[model samples]
Target chain A: MGGGKEARRGDVLLSGEGLVRRYDDATVVDVDSIEVRTGEVLAVLGPNGAGKSTLLRLLAALEAPEDGRLLYRGRAVGRDDPELRRTVAAVLQRPYLWRGTVAGNVEFALKARRLSASERRERVRQALQMVDIVDLADVPVDTLSGGEAQRVALARALAVEPEILFLDEPTADLDVSVRRRLLGDLERIVRHAAPAIVLVTHDPGEAFALADRVVVMEGGRIVQAGTPAEIFESPATEFVASFTGAEFMLNGTVSKVDEGTMTVRLESGASLEAAGSAEPGARVRVGYRPEDVVVSLPQSSSTSARNRFDTTVAHLHPRGGLVRLRLEADSLSLEAVITRHAMEELGLQVGTSVVAQVKATALHVFPA
Target chain B: MDVLVDAARQALALLLSGDPYLWGIIARSLQVSGSAVALGLLVGIPIGTWLGLTRFPGRGIAVALVNTGLALPPVVVGLFVYLLLSRQGPFGELGWLYTTSAMIAAQVVLAAPYVAAITLAAVQAVPPELRLQARALGAGRWQALLLHLREARLSLMAAVAAGFGAVISEVGAVMMVGGNVHGETRVITTAIVLETRRGQFATAMALGLILLAIAFAANAFITRVQQAAPRRRRPLTS
Candidate 1:
């Protein structure tokens, strides 16, 4: 078993190479290639109708591909292969409980494998305890709260002790607090169980917090795939940049370069320094997180930073504790996230001229 | 109006007198209809479940045919069964004509399609996600089928009840096939016909009332069974 574990760890547990599933003229899933490595959580993030759920279904073998193949453990598997089926489990967006007590749903998968009655009972107990719903075991499944039902569904999947777990919007309908708790519990379980998890979610924070790597899908194909940090820091395309909420895009010419840092002169005549290696004359697209740009009243005798510009506030949108100030300087439009306290102290309003100060390390520059 | 009231009073007296002939007819009706419903359920449920679960060529046509069977007239079925089971007919050598067996056989034909069509609709009503979830949990196709059937059991019971109701009340096929023999083949409906034709209005009216009561009782029993059966739960042991 140890040798088998090592061999399996090196093997790709789930692989979809050139998978294509189309409905009439609409393609639901068109993947060039995607692989879930052993014990890794790969979150597939996309907007609604972006084919994330469809990809999970294709991986789970619930649906057949119109074209291409899905392989498990270096062998081809269709929707009917018993060995492949045993190694994979999925929690759908809306889980169904078989008519029975909560204990019954959890025990179903174990019983399917023909485990002894004692073994099945033990497994079901462990699963129920893992999801913190052992007390609800005797309760009828239909009477469970939404969160409780979802937990039972998760427990049912875990009872199988699968090698791969697919979660398609597991927390899509859950409230924020419940979602956080479940996600945290799930992260712990995935770490301990060491199953390759493929989570499809629309929540950016959930993806960033739980996934070791994130794959962004749009219109039935993968747009980008990388570590969350890599994807967030330097998005490969405009779509990724925008989808990940790195929304502000500025075109500029490099004015100065020093040690992997470049000061860019925007077309709006504002100067911004970014952490990138670029020649002095190269044109580049510079981006920044809204939170990275600070808005404040003009300060005299301040330390000279690489990027600072005085701009009029075009819009002030308050969101929670943060206020997003859309500032305009000539043709340059930048968004800065300031605290409500800061906004109040600075007496900021739309059309009020203020200094939009940005840290050089906070800006990301990519060649045009 | 006086004569109608006198006839109704006479009918009530005959019914209260516990006539042996009327009891015999009632017994025969129970025997044939009960056997028919059992046979129909045995054959129809599995076929309906299979048809609903498995995707095959001509599946739509098959379902359509079964749904069409739901509206099949009893007289037409009686004619068809009579042609097949009568002397000089294809099955004449079996010596099954004008007997309880022939009645049961005819009623089975009438009831089977009712069972099949209702069970099909019941199975189809189960959400596809439930099947997908079962499959994802490493359940084989057979296991998924069992789970889906368990989930749809209530509706399936209602289908069975409908089929039972259909078989129990049907008279055309049994009359045509059984030949209404005096003791052996004479059932409630045929006996009623015989008494009415003989101008034994009291006995006929009494048999008619008893038959209506039997039908009502059978339906009430089925409904109570349906209501008493445990609500569908995802089966733990399957």
Candidate 2:
């Protein structure tokens, strides 16, 4: 991952400025500027109704923005511009396959361009082989499973060898295993081809897995845009933090500020030190992931975590091999995740008192 | 009972013997209805596709008008065509009255609406995203539209079947404009009516059976064509 973003990113292929889309009385997408660079995967991550798909549509020129201009290689382009259309392709959430055999579906895009029959056949062969579905070429689309159908959709898009690809939750409806396989295949294919890709998804894990740059969107606007590590480590807002797996939130008021460090007094009378400066008496929120909170026996002071809380376990939620413990202290509650092996060793159950520790760097502080 | 038995026996004899008069009426019926449906397809597919796939200010009214045509009674259409082809009407100078051309014109009016309405329904039935997908894949406007039509092709065949069904079986329109002239404009439906009125029950029964067989054969052919692609799946050797 060293210098991955700068090393892999190529020249800007497409850009949008002052894009806005409104449906009737409500604006569904509003973005000031966005760029898509060659050989880079850009993920638009957000919750449902966040207009991420709408933004993709705008950038892809599938739907013209009500107010904005799209530049493809420094030239303004319209949704109906054949030049723009020839270089771009999109695979939607649902496959929307034509009523035909697999090979026919793949050949359709090629046929649209009025390509010769030989070239179409060759490209169709290559695309199906790329998706590893060449054997099913002659099978009708209706008999394909969902995963297979999605592969055919991908193959159809790939057949034209587009310069840009837009994927709108390509694996949203798939099962976990199927999703993983498709994601793996997609990663390999996209990396090999190195086309500028705009992937719209709600799953942060997917963004992390594929994106070099992540743009977190909310409320029809982009809230933050940065490298995936930058987004995961220093989210700019509570929504971003929580959406990226920082579920534990505590509201507090700053009590002391010194040397880029501040101590915040929690509502439960617990004071915690975090690495950020704020005016004393300023209200703020502290957020952290469950895995960042360490649990230990009361007498064990072997860890160097800056803040420690003695709390009793209120509930235990087991997720696969990991267990999530809801710990309650005096008038305060927080969650911590520990391994099943650790829980067994500690003999921790509801009402068992233990110490929870978090390092100052683990806490993300934002104005409430 | 005896009259019915005699008519059925004589009807089979007339059919097997291929009576030239009866065969001529059958041939005329096919010619008029076939030409009308072909004309209907020429006129209806584009209008229906345009209405179905695009949005414009009067689209609703246009659609409503097409829907209204779907329910238009054959006799009403016949009377409308009758007045137009009559000697004193607007198109009277054409002198097409009591001729096969007039009958074809009347059936065209009847069949075009069926083609249009069904084509509209078929186009609308395709998933809207399909056209968008085609465009996203670099299909030109008309190419996307052709793709949409191809996707709705099976249903379009039904449109053709419906149009043919409406005109071929219809007696009113053809009879009014055709005038059922002997050796000239008489078609299956009209000839059956004439024979029945003249107490030529055997000939009428024979014509009736031929009409049913033609309708069945046409629909069956369309159904077969519609089902051919969907049911075919080559077995994968790998």
Per-candidate TM equals 0.88, 0.93
Candidate 1: C-alpha lDDT? 0.83
**Model 2 residue A309 distance off true place after TM-score fit, in angstroms:** 2.0
The residue pairs in collision within model 1 are: A98-B233, A98-B234, A99-B232, A99-B233, A99-B234, A100-B233, A100-B234
Q: Over the stretch A64-130, how does candidate 2's per-residue lDDT look in tens digits? A: 9999899988779998888889989998878999987999999999988889999999999999998
Kindly list the per-residue Cα lDDT of model 2 for residues B51-170, writing each as its tens digit. Answer: 988899999999999989888888888899999978899999999999999999989888888899989988998998999888888888889889999999888988988899889999
**Which stretches of model 2 miss by more than 4 angstroms?**
A1-9, A298-300, A341-348, B86-95, B216-238
Find the candidate with the highest lDDT and give its number: 2
Q: For each candidate, what is the lDDT?
A: 0.83, 0.89
What is the lDDT, from 0 to 100, of the residue A218 in candidate 2?
Answer: 93
Clashes (candidate 1): 7
lDDT of model 1 at position A189: 78
Q: Can you write out model 1's per-residue Cα lDDT over B1-238, one digit (the tens) per residue?
A: 8755666688788767877777788788888888998899888888798788789999999988888888888888888888888787999888898889988998888788888887787788889889899999999998998899888887777766777678767778888888899989888788878888998877777777777776687578667755764444453211
- Per candidate, native contacts kept equal 0.65, 0.58
Model 1 residue B131 CA deviation (Å) reads 0.4
Candidate 1, residue A325: lDDT: 82
